[model samples]
Target: MFLISDMLVRIVPLCLYSHTGYYARFFTYNVIGGIAWVAVCVFGGFWFGNIPIVKNNFELVILIIIFVSVLPVVFHLFKRRSENKIITKPLAEVVEERAN
Candidate 1:
């Protein structure tokens, strides 16, 4: 997640409301979410992974988690490429809009 912190659902609200004292709001959200994530992952693994079935399939579980975590980022990159192409438009269209 740190690798793509610059691009997340968290960043959108932070940037959009930056001028509205969004620091406290964003920080609170980040702290709570971070703690929840760490707690769930650490404790869940500590307890659940001890199960015979889970222990035997630990590698597969990890792979699934990694795939779920990275899926959003992969989709975001694909969407961004199409959005960039649409946003460029043409110089003449821009000049015409400014004239209006």
Candidate 2:
């Protein structure tokens, strides 16, 4: 899962950086980031998976984790949408007035 998602997410940036001749720096950063990611995820799950609450309410815990992970993404999308609307609305009205 992590491998697939990481590949999908990193593919474009990796290509762009490699194209720009930052492959060495990108490779170092990617290696460090990958190690940290694995360590955090493995240790975090090992530490948390043993908890009685998490073990008992596994589905709920998973749901909460998914919700927390998605919250920021949803917020950023909404924020960008609102910003686009604000920026475009005045310009659209001006265009309409000019056409009239």
Candidate 3:
């Protein structure tokens, strides 16, 4: 909670400060990350409590939190990449047409 919350506090406002609609984007993304963190923590705690390898409870919790934080960021990046691909395809085709 603390790590995510700290990131939210820093990122959300910074994004907002840059432009108008950034506040909305910031809130929406932070909420999504928050929800994912909650879900992962709940499931990990209940399912893996007795795993001997992750014996220390705190370490297990931190690992779960980091995973939650990272996974969503990766997903977001992948989505951005796909969106960029969609945008660039038409522009590339136009440039090719001009070249021809």
Candidate 4:
């Protein structure tokens, strides 16, 4: 289940991007959601270990958590920073052009 969710989380973004150019929010949402997922996974693992059923799935759960959480946040942050940097220089140029 966790693996499936991770795959879906990844594929959905690609699918959205292919279908639409304006799905940038997915990046932001993915970052935020991924953080939340990691928090839950780390803490939940600790808590769930107290329960037998949850403990049995610990490895799978951790793998999914890392995949779903770490990947999206890291990818999105890099993408956002790179894009913003590209725009900043152009934006300054436009401002200078307008001022003159």
Measured by lDDT, the strongest candidate is: 2
- Give one digit per residue, the lDDT tens place, for model 2 in 22-79: 9999999999999999999999999999999999999999999899999998998999
Query: Number of backbone collisions per candidate, in order?
Result: 0, 0, 0, 0
RMSD (Å) per prediction: 10.0, 7.7, 12.0, 16.2
TM-score, cand. 3 vs. native = 0.35
Question: Candidates ranked by TM-score, best first?
Answer: 2, 1, 3, 4
* Candidate 1 C-alpha lDDT tens digits along 1-100: 7758757765777776686878888788889999999999999879998899889998898899899999999999999987877547588998999999
Evaluate candidate 2 by giving its C-alpha RMSD to the native, one decimal: 7.7
Candidate 4: tens digits of C-alpha lDDT, residues 31-62: 89989999999998678787876677878867
Q: Which candidate should be chosen as best, given TM-score against the real structure?
A: 2
For candidate 3, write residues 1-100 as lDDT tens digits. 6799999988867666567757667778779998999999999777776676656676777888799989988998999998876444677888998899
Predicted structure 4, TM vs. truth: 0.35
Q: What is the C-alpha lDDT of each candidate?
A: 0.86, 0.91, 0.80, 0.82
The TM-score obtained by model 2 is 0.48
